[model samples]
Target: MTTSRSFVLICTVGIFCFISYNMVRMPALSLFAESLGAGPERIGLIVSVSTLTGVLLKLPSGALSDIYGRRFLLRIGVVAFGLPPFLYPFITSLDALTALRFLHGLATAIFAPSALATVAELYRERRGAALGTYTACTQSGSLLGPFLGGYLIHAAGFSTAFVTAGVFGCVAMVLFYSLHLDVSVPQRKEQGTAAVLSEMWKGFSVVAKNTKVLITSVTDAAKMIANGALMAFLPLYGVSAGLNPGEVGLLFTVQACTSFFSKPIMGRVSDRMGRQPLILLGLSICAGTFVCIPHVSMFPVLLLLSAGFGFGEAVVSSSSSALVADSSEFKTLGAGMGMQGTIMDIGHASGPLLAGLLIASLSYPMAFGVIAGVQLLAAGVFWVTMKRM
Candidate 1:
């Protein structure tokens, strides 16, 4: 029940929960949609529907956490993560798949902000490092999930992969329910529905008006735009380039591995050096690496690009979340984190749709180059905005 113990438990739960979530996400989801006869545009829709759920719900969920409690919302989130993978095996059409993905999106929309606020509260003195480590734990899921999912799909087929993902999710649910989290919930004398709604709205108003939080979040969203694009198209691109599904999965694993290793180190550095420089540097690195992805067909070269992009991601993420925490009021911490999530999801959802349109009309190289350009432009705007502030 100590803070350290609670942090560890949360991180552990995050690992299993994300592993469950990602196994269904990567190469598997796109490939499954393809089997259902989807084109690039429809595939993009299926992939982005989940993120759209986050755009609509993350801020409200975060605000509600401030009024209700982190644990209460977290329980719902784990259940969301746990139960949905079981239905993937039954999905027969693109419409069913897209609907299921949106329903599944509720897991992260509800869980992420509360979990982040809890970590920020737990280690107020070294939020960068603490948040980095926690996020790295979740990144471990990203590292392993694709590899397992890809292997399952290649060896056994989609049903086995989905069922296995469900098992991991169930494990997370059980662990979360069994452990007693020691984090304190805010005490409110008014338990009326109207009072709760008013409190939630106040949290929203405060977060919306915070310029620093908004800027930091928008910067993070720029990076997520590229991440989302890669998640949607990289597998198909890799396969087209002569890599198998397993190899495609490894590409993602390598990218995630680089991020997993770098986040804590970069986070500690950010804690001492300040966040703005790292954010700008990370964006530049992301732009440089991302624009090069489509110019190469070699597996080794693609892996290198993936790793570089991942490091850039680590650098940005390690600083951005901590920066948002630093800029928020303690009372509305959940709402601040939620606001960031909402903006990031908006960018995330747009990435696939935009990339799909571009790739369909132009080429892969052009699509990636344009998205990378967006990152650089965002960095320039972020730099000027931060300097003036």
Candidate 2:
């Protein structure tokens, strides 16, 4: 396939896969777990179990992709995304749903690194913009998923929502299957299991030693901590502040819309102006907005804060993936991305858990402030580390 066709296909796959994934992620998953008699702790665990899958599988999946091939893992990942929601309606307990969420998490674990690696290889010169655009496509799914899921659940029911999500997932799988590519890197020919392990270890070692990749990934993790906290608690907080369900949902939409619009632009800017500056700027914006979230109860002000956080997120994310790609050896790009994914998932999982603890023990304002402080410290460490680079 022509490069353009391949790019379009890949981007479309990103959009639909995320749409399917997120449709069950936000309001739907939490509400579903609640209906199954889950408490706040159980619900938090259920929500984070999917990320735990990414944390476990991403590095090895990525290394395997580097040694074997992208398409093979990509296909498996798509299957994971496409096939899982059909089983949601069968879930009779929180345990069943949690197990399914972990299984569904495998989709992102295998797909994200492979997909980013493919984009990196395909547009080496214009990688920042390409990665940003691809991420933005996924963000579009995020933009739509919560609102769509919330509406469906309210109007129809959980079963219908899951079924609709399944349909989107199948559509994504079909689009992914049709792509033809000459873009994949030549695979290593290892004769035995031991040889494969050796190659995989080499890939891991290469990414492990890259200071630039490690530092940038850690900073990105800090950002995701704030993001995860918001995802877990924002709706509750909004409702507590007198906003209706629709208004609470709109907050997420505004944030996603800002990110969808800003990522590609920020990515191109990173390509031209250098990534470090934007990463620093974005972190500061994220920290500031996050700290302010608990300070305002007004919808317009909250909306602005949410949008600011989203724009900051777009700036950081658009650069971070490209930076990892830049820092990695050409052959180990997948492994490097996998490392980033794993670390980011760790932060993502931690976010909700820690927030739950803090909010339980203290006030929302205090919990948010402390999280924002972590981001500030991350920015400092990132600045200091990158200065030597």
Candidate 3:
């Protein structure tokens, strides 16, 4: 397939895949867990466990995609995305639902790095813009998913919401299967298992020793820490603060809308001006906006802050993936992205767990403040490291 066609097809796949993901993820997951008699801590576990799957699998999946091919893994990943939500309506208990979320998490664990690696390959010269555009498509899905999920839950119920999400997921899978070209087989001679292992290790070491990739991944992780916290708790907080489910969903929509609008522009700027400065700026924006979330009670004020967070998120993310791809060897792009996903998922998984503990013991301000502090420290460390290097 032509690069343009591939890019459009991939973006379309991302949109539907993420729509399915966020539909079940946001207001629905927490609220559904709540309905099942889960408390804050359990809810946090349920929310974060899906990301736990990513932390464990993303590196291996990405590495495997490098050794094998992108399309095969992508096919598997999209299947994971397409099928799981259909089972959600049948879930009977918290444990069962958590298990399903973990399963669903596998979809992203597989798809994300593979798809990213494909994009990196497809647009080696304009990676920043390409990655930005692809992510923006997913963010647009996020924008629509939560709002639709919340409205459906409020109007029709969880069963209807979940089933609808399943349908979108299936559509994404179909589009991906139909449109993505088969990965071209490499010309390398067939290798023994030991040789394969050695190649994988080489790729691993390539990414591990790259300071730029490491720093960028950690900085991205810091952003995700805040992002994950907001994603897990914001709906509950908004509801507690007297916002309805639809309104809470709109908050996510607003945040995603801002991100959708900002990422491609920021990505183009990163291509021109370099990535580190943009990454630093974006991290600062997220840290500040995140710390202020608990202080705002008005819906409009919260919306503005969420938008700020989104823009921050956009700038960092658009640059970070491109930076990782830039830092890796040509053959190890998937490994680099895998490492990035693994690190980011660690932060993402930790967010809900840490926030759950903090909120249980301290006030929301204190909880959010500590998360914000982590982002600031990461930014500071990243700046110092880059300067010294």
Candidate 4:
């Protein structure tokens, strides 16, 4: 397939796949866990277990894709995304739900790095714009999924919502299967198991040592910490604040909608104006908005805060991935992206756990304030570290 066709196909598949994934993820997952008798800490665990999967597997998957090829890994990823939601309806206990979430985590863990690497390879010159556009497509899923999932759960129920998510995932699988990706795989002279392991290790070692990649990933991780916290707790908080599930979902939708619209524009700006400044600006925006979330209980005000957070997310994300790509070796690109994913997942996984602990021990305002502080601290470190480098 032509590069343009391939990019479009990938974006299309991404939209559907994420739509499926997010429908189960956001308001639904936390609420479902609550229904199953989970408390704040348990709910945090259930939400983060999926990210834990990404933390463990993303690097290896990305490295393996660098050796084996993106298409092969992507196929597995789509299956992971498509099949797991079908099992949510059967989850009667928190343990089962946690296990399923971990399994479902495999979908993004495998697909994201490979797809990102593919996009980078496809548009070597305009990576910021390309990655931004691709991610914006995925964010579109974030935009729509919560809205749909919330509406479904409110109108029908969790079972219906999950089943519908499964359908979207299935559609993504079908679309991915039909598309012919013409990306080239690395050629290896040795075909032994040891050789493959050595190849993967080499990719890992190289990426792990790249200071720029590491810094960029960590900065991105700081943002994800806040994002993850919101995903796990926002629904509960909204309900407590007198919003319905549908309204809670709209909070996520507004956030995602702002992100979806801003990413490509911010990405192109990052391309022209440079990434570090935008990263700093975004971090500040996130911190400012995030620390204010629990201070207000009004719906209109909450929506505004959510949108601010989303725009910050778009700014940080649009630049950070491209920065990683720019910093990585061409041959180890997948590993670089994977390293970013792994670190970001670590931060993402930590968010809910940390927030749960803080909220349990203290209050929502304090919890959010503390997390927002973490973002500011990370921004400081990134700036100093980058300057010295």
Candidate 5:
């Protein structure tokens, strides 16, 4: 393989490690905080604050990658990403935890945009397959994390699980450092603030005006909301229904296994069959499956729903990313992906909190129902917009 391809694979493996590191701690943060004498409100603040920071910063990071070189910005992500997990054990107060979470969000803001920007640069000609492979790597990392955590927490406790994530991240950083790329963020000879703003505005303008991207972003955002709930709430949901930790872990496995294969298949199909139809079908399936989720409580039902959810997300995630990369220039592709991440993060940030609230007041079914409805609407939007494109 070429250097860039090898680099992409290395970065992907690091991402896998990163998710494996964080998966257990993130989903179980509320429980971990509870052990530390925090309640839902505190956990909410910690989680939301971090999420909010990441959501808002994607745009600037993308712009920076465009202007400053993907290498510099990616290094920012590596340091930010690799170092944060070490500090978790040092957090003695809720405020400290919340502050760390916010800082941690910067890792995603920097890394995802820059890393994805690398793929966009190397695979510009075949992003559907390339990003499919890329996202699948992340899903694989996410897949491994919870299972590792569930087992590890019993053996080592929460702090071990949390601190270990940082250590694993160092492994990823080392690999990321070794990989080389051909693209540098376009450099300028000392431009004015107005010039920078104009450039940023132009990126936003393309995001707003492009039909393929608008549809792709909106639809994928909706799909992420559904997934956000599943990843965020499945453990509670499993326990509430009287399932064991093993069972809960299995659900994650099912989702991951299907999604692992879903991307590569979807990518080849999109290349052969076309992007829009596949995107539309994926969203419809995803929405329908989420609607079926709340009603399921048995082992068979859980397995089916997990696979369904995985299939839906896998299809949409790869397709939408490729579409976004397709829609923009190399100069702003990272920013474009960042904008995509930002939009998706909005749905992700909202999905969990809303599900928690709904589960408290209404029913789990209601939460899933609402998410499904949003996705259905999004599917429509995708079709209409893609038709125009």
Candidate 6:
């Protein structure tokens, strides 16, 4: 492969690893914290706090990518993402775990938007196709992580699993730097901090003011909220419904693989069909699927239910990022990606926390049922604004 191709491939794979490192530990963390005497609310706090940091940091990280260059900024994120995994195995207290998680969140903040910017930069004209292939790596990682975690935990222990994650993260970091991605190096050929900040704010301001940006960003935010619930509550829901860990793991695998495989196709279809119809369809399916989950107790029935969320999400995620990139000007791409990250993080930040609260006060069915409503509401917003567009 050419150097450029190699660079893109490697960096994309590294992004996969970063996501994997963040997620694979999730089930384990829940178990660990519970064993350490943390309650459901505390576990929610631990997860939410980490997301809160990512929410806070995405914009700055994007602006930093804009000013510093994608390559250099990503390098920093890789290190940040990697270091926390190492610490995971050693931490004892929930408070310490929260602190480590917060640090780990910084890595996500750094790696994702910058890496996205790099992907957007690579195939500027084919935004959907480009992002689909790139983002699919993340989905694939999401698929592998839990599967890997499930087996590892059953076999060795959570400590071993944590250390394994750290090792993979370190490898991903090394591979990332070695690939020498062509993304810009953050440094001033001729610009001061004030100018850079001004440009960053300008990007944010522009996106906020644009109607398309607002609607699409909101659409994405809603999908992320559902995603957040899926990640945080799905396993619990499965367990509550009497799924063994193996069945639960199988559900994750199917959803993730379906989502992963479907991305490029959805991206292409969205390009041809226009974003609105696909958005509406995807959201409707998601909402319908959520309602199904509460009803299905059989393993096969639940697996099909899980597929609905996955398929809907694949369409939304691939198309939404493409839309965000499409709506933004080229010069402000970094800021645009940052804006996308920031908006989605709002829902992402709230999903698990809100779901946990609902589960605590109400029930898992009620919590996820409300999420379905949110999905429908997001679809409505898209339909109204999209018609105007």
> What TM-score do all the candidates reach, one by one?
0.99, 0.96, 0.98, 0.99, 0.90, 0.93
Please report the TM-score between candidate 5 and the true structure.
Answer: 0.90
For candidate 1, which ten residues in a row score worst on lDDT? 182-191
Off by over 4 Å in 4: none
lDDT of 4 by residue, 1-389 (tens): 99999999999999999999999998999999999999999988999999999999999999999999999999999999999999989889888898899999999999999999999999999999999999999999899999999999999999999999999999999999987987987777889899999999999999989999999999999999999999999999999999999999999999999999999999999999999999999999999999999999999999999999999999999999999999999999999999999999999999999999999999999999999999999999999999999
Considering TM-score, which of the candidate structures 2 and 6 is the better prediction for this target?
Answer: 2
Please give the lDDT score at residue 112 for candidate 3: 95
Q: Which prediction has the highest lDDT against the true structure?
A: 4
Tens-digit lDDT track for model 5 on 116-205? 777778766777887788778777766776666655565667677776676767777776677665564475876988887787787777
Whole-model lDDT values for every prediction: 0.93, 0.88, 0.91, 0.95, 0.73, 0.75
What lDDT does candidate 2 reach at residue 35?
A: 79
Better of 1 and 6 by lDDT: 1
Q: Where does model 3 exceed 4 Å of error?
A: 191-193
lDDT of 2 by residue, 29-109 (tens): 877887799765676688888999999999999999988888888889988889998999999988889899999999999
As a TM-score, model 4 comes out at 0.99
Model 1, span 1-389: residue lDDT tens: 99999999999999999999999998899889988999888888888899999999999999988888899999999999999999999999888899899999999999999999889989999999999999999998899999999999999999999999999999999999999987888789998989999999999999999999999999999999999899999988998999998999988899999999999999999999999999999999999999999999999999999999999999999999999999999989999999999999999998888888888999999999999999999999999999999
Q: What's the ranking of the predictions by lDDT, best on top? A: 4, 1, 3, 2, 6, 5
Task: Give the higher-lDDT candidate: 3 or 6.
Answer: 3
Against the true structure, candidate 6 reaches a TM-score of 0.93
Candidate 3 has a TM-score of: 0.98
